[model samples]
Target: MRAFIAAICLFLLCGNAVANSVQDSTTPADAIVKALYDNLSAAYLCRDIVDADKYLKTRSVVEATMLAFTNKQDASETILKKWEDEIQINLKYQNQNISVEECNTLLRARTHQLYVAMDTLFK
Candidate 1:
């Protein structure tokens, strides 16, 4: 009877640990996506082209920034600062008000723009 109890306790503990680890592992991706969106939104709102440029890690983002800021080189610093500030605010509001649908829409628009630019640039 004692051995049975010990085995059950070990099983439960292990299962809990696995569940916790899985939850932890999935959090970073969400965090990354949130940060990306927050950065993009700040850039869009502030018209801070430079900061917007910084957040474009992918080709799509770069293309989007180029398209959006084609004539606004003077506001680069302001935009970058705005992006940083937005990131700080997002950290404070982490897991609040993030909309995956919005993120998808923004990403798709940026990517499509990027592809168009690539075609033009290559041509």
Candidate 2:
């Protein structure tokens, strides 16, 4: 009976450790950007230009600024906010001069930026 209890305890402990390890290994930033990209792409594919434009413009500016700046918490926050504001302004003018292809190009650039940022930050 004692051996059975000990074995059960060991199994639970090992399982918990494994779960925690997996959680720790997951990169939150990468996951966030990837999900954002996927959803944005889906929106564009569905011809939801408004939603796609919003996501792509906001993410593109933020990710680009983040990738360009040195890794610092304060700088990241500041640049991200600035980028967001810029994106909002740009979005207002989107209908006047923007095209689907341009949005796609910006999104691709942002994706590249995200990858570079993750590489630099994680490494």
Best by TM-score: 2
lDDT of 1 by residue, 1-123 (tens): 455334433332232212012333233222222333443543343233233443445424523442343333433334444444555565443444535455455555644543554444335
Candidate 2: RMSD over Cα atoms?
Answer: 16.6
Candidate 1: residue 107 lDDT (0-100): 50
List ranges where model 1 is wrong by over 4 Å.
1-98
Question: CA RMSD for every model?
Answer: 20.3, 16.6
**Deviation of model 2 at 8, angstroms:** 43
Give the clashing pairs for model 2.
none
Q: Total clashes, candidate 2?
A: 0
Model 2 stretches with alpha carbons more than 4 Å out? 1-86, 90-96
lDDT of 2 by residue, 1-123 (tens): 455334433332232211012242234343333433333333333234445556656555544534443344564455445434443454333344556776566556646645664564456
